[model samples]
Target: MHQNTRQRLINNFPRSSAQHLPNTSNANGSSNLRRVGYIEYDMSRMLGESVKTFVYVGYVVEKSLESIVDKKKVAVKKIVCGSAEDCQKNLQEVKILLNCDEHENIVKYYKTETDQDFNVYIAMELCLGTLQQWMEGNIPTIQPENVNPVQLLKQTTKGVAYLHGKRDAIIHRDLKPDNILLKLVGGKVCVKIADFGISRVLPHERTSLTIKTYSGTRGWKSPEILNAHSSPPGNLRAHPRMTRATDIFSLGCVFYYVLSGGRHPFDQNGNSPNPELRDPNILRDRKNTKIEHFSPRIGGYIRLLEQMIDKAPQQRPSAAEILSSPLFWGHDKELNFLVHISNLMQENKSPVIQWCKNQIEEDHSNNEDEFLPGLELNNVGWMNRTCEALDFYFMYESPRTYDEFLTKDLIRAIRNMGTHYETLSPSVKASVGSLPGKFMAFWNNRFPFLVQTVWNVCKVLITDPDFDSVLMFYQTG
Candidate 1:
């Protein structure tokens, strides 16, 4: 491990009973350490054998009691690296996950952990199950009355939002009946986003994050992605970079499938021109792919596809903007739930605020275990420098002044949260409630005077007159 990353792990390691405690201390005073092990194991661990250990739910990985006993509930993604591209894919995924973490309908990304070749994992929330299972088996069959247009709109938005990339082909390659999943907590349903390996980031402007080849299943490819018409002159080989429109095309297919009761929209009825529906380049046959055309009454549900499946990448609305569309107002159940949770968080101070005040006031000088994730999580120089301006205010100015700054920031966060909540719909809002307390605590202690500064930074970045698109996170389908 690099010295900087090792220290980051030590500083951010949580104090919880769920993690196993081992006798791992060394003579040196380092709070934590990573050892190089040479164990005698059979050839099975070499081939990346799939052994199903009872770990976090909705996960495809192995786990041991010692490592995960404490963080018992986190959903981790474990990928067995078998090729150079696989390793590079994991690294690129880690880079993107770390830098960009925004959006309401998208899954909350935590940290990516690398455990040599023996193991690799991406820990996130554990949701109920996939959408394919829900649509083909239970929900559509038993609860037809509960088919929610708004919730479907919002949930799919979240799926495409995560799949939103700097490059267009960075879409959900495996977008199908079975890939979508749902989990309910606190009496509200939330969309769970997953499957990173098959997915890649799409580039926005002409840049390096562009697609290298046409990957993913054949069924999900867009018209342009499926054909070689975009090939540059004098070159027989096409430019393989997938565009933003790739996902919108797949999204059109997914919605058509759901509306058709698991029927393929492209299936032929004797007179079909392209009976296979394998080539996405020809979409004229799709008018017959839908199971039943959306009526003016229900037509609204599928009508939005006119723009989403446009042949051009520039025509599709971004994931964040789509979440705010009027088409989602009445159909989705998840959107309604997010709206409620966001409103709840907007009132007064959040629970995390009280937790931080209690911790800072009571533990100011008290003795505690060395494993606490406070103090050096970020360098004191950097962490303190965030408040360099506030330092003068706190030392020379009154506490009342700092309190006012805090209140203003909290209010701003609440208002922003409201817009985000409305975009995400309620299902997403409910899921995010898990972290507000932690975020609030961190905001008050870490930033000290957040309301006054974060917006100042946001204004210069997000809304500046000279601003253009080079996103830390891309939220479009």
Candidate 2:
């Protein structure tokens, strides 16, 4: 670590003093070193990113003598400073930790320890694992109790908001999923932002800062940072200029990663025709291509992501602006839930559709009406949700009609609902009937089962004199 940077870190804890503790250990290799308020333990081998800092898993004991002993698992980062660069990086992380208050979305920083070598050990609250590892293991799905990517992203945004709202706004140059760690909160996994090694603190009054030092992961780095270089033949490139918006771009990449189940938004994969984008390094191509292809599951959040990773920094919303976005406030849960269910339904239709029918049956009473109450589409919010769900179903599973996905029981349920078209609300009649034509028009082939069902409903509904508007929509829509 640089002398000045080390001094700044020391300044943050002026009253603190370090005491050398004996490295006494048991047969299992757990340490018995105890401080006034902390009990240090033997850490496991180093893990995490290949940076100068080393992170290990350990536990800390607090208030041992007070008879209120509490042992907490923690991630201890040991920085054996070998150069000025290492010092600055560690110091930067420590500074951000000191400046920010404890937030649920942000990793909790305990205290820093220095050995005789002046090496710094930063102790922090440990988590279950990194978001990257979690995603790799669990993957993305809309299972009822599974971890929702939407909720994880919300937690990440809140952490960023906390950083940006501080007196000295902190810019996390690297905001990839790897830097996001998770904790089981109230039986639900919550995301917490960590690893501020490359983060920078900007003056609160300053809207922008000219940072020539280029830092961040290759594929996840912002365009401005990559393009800031001025090439000189046979010489190393210059550092890039950066702003707070850099993090937003990287976040968009994270969002894309989560949405596509580990696929890069800009890179070519099974869906891409252009072979060039299939290369390992996609940072250069990301700015060149428009993100036209993504998982249809993420279609709802695509617009928000576009704004987040906009080429022009000024065009992207700030952390505070993102919090107020309608995307966060409205129908996201229901929409995301439906999107997940639809994804499963499209992938393996028969079982998922059967599961949906079973769930509807299990949840509702045998009142024999409104098996799927939301399908009535009386609520405008629910109408939009159902429309999108049906649209996604038809658009993705084209040529394979509902006959393959829907079981006999589900089809009977629809037919039973169709029998009472004359007694149905005008809105319900129009909404239910409109789905068939929309599906047929989109797929360019009328689905027989759906058509027959809606046709039967229309036959009964048309008898009502007030069904004129509903009849027109049912036939022409």
Candidate 3:
């Protein structure tokens, strides 16, 4: 430890209290110190360190009749503030954590204390380790079976959504794997998003803010933030401003990292054989890179990531929009959506049906063979196919029209599955419920354009008062 840090620790805990605890030094050269407080931290067991803070492994200690017993373990983040502005910045993180601690996917905040020297000590729920450490193989106790990459992404997305949905929308300017912690909750691995030191909370009525200084890590940063500091004064507005969408881009990168088993999409060539040119090479690649490295097995998640990391900030989906994606939906939810769409297809007078038909016609006219090849228009119009059509489109290699899939394939699957769902075994139901990947695969392979097409139509329908109840059913049900 630095002399100043050691001196500060000694000053914070007086000599009288220090004598009660054991004094020891570890192989790594960190020495132990005793402190007097409701929560006691083992100064020797440092968890991590940043430029402004040091995190130590701590425990809630209480005195019993027999001896002193440690009740619960926690993490103590000691932030050193040199000036008033630095202290306020450190306090902002505590304030944000306190406000958002109710969420399961967010790190839980306990209590905070300050020393006479203006140093802030925050006690928070301790996690096994960081996602970065786990990804790098530093955490041996957590095996592959204990961690679910998709679940981790879903939980993190939920936390982000909660923050963005606050009255004063909070933008987590810095979101990277290092800031994401992992904990064992009820024998299963859970994700907890941490580190709000650089987060920004927008005022009511304000959606975005323009900051003079740059924030966020390179490679993980959205293109907007990367260019914010370099744009000319007159072109500032042209550059994307800081908003909740900024975190979406970083979340996409983190998702890529988790799925790829630690490789950064923008920095794939960062650690090449030529050591001297790595940094410059990564910088150049990020400047002009298109994401193309994700495994095809990820299915629709690839498409979702593409939308998230789009260069235009406004084009990216909101956190809530991301939660509605098929990537996060259960098989029942997906089947429900398909059945709902099938029912809408029966009502030819419905605006959703009319709009989808127009889009299908437009797509067919523009891309002919690519959109719906080998279809004989003289056979039957799409409006004629209703719930009465029992033919299965899944039996056929491909559908001749969008209505065929919606009315025939989708309806038949729902009927066949719904009728037998109760009779099926529990294991079979488990297999059936875990079908997001297969659902995405089916759509991506068969109807390549349907997902975006339907979403676009739904966006239009949401604004119509007549479709309010219909939209509510689709959203909530």
Which candidate achieves the best lDDT against the true structure? 3
Candidate 2 lDDT for residue 8: 73
Task: Report the candidate with higher TM-score, 1 versus 3.
Answer: 3
Candidate 2 versus truth, CA RMSD in Å, comes to 15.1
What's the CA error at residue 448 for candidate 3, in Å? 7.1
lDDT of each: 0.43, 0.55, 0.63
* Error at 251, model 3, angstroms: 1.4
How do all models score by TM-score?
0.48, 0.61, 0.70
- For model 2 the local lDDT of residue 459 reads 39
Regions of model 2 farther than 4 Å from truth:
1-20, 23-41, 45-49, 63-70, 83-89, 138-145, 229-240, 270-297, 329-477
Candidate 1 local lDDT, 412-440, one digit each (tens): 43345434434443443443343444323
Q: For residues 71-118, what per-residue lDDT tens digits would candidate 3 score against the true structure? A: 667888888896656665677787777667778988997656555456
The superposed Cα distance between candidate 2 and the true structure at residue 6, in angstroms, equals 17
lDDT computed for candidate 2: 0.55
Q: Report the C-alpha displacement of residue 52, candidate 1, in angstroms.
A: 14
Q: Can you rank all candidates by TM-score, best first? A: 3, 2, 1
Error of 1 at 233 (Å): 12
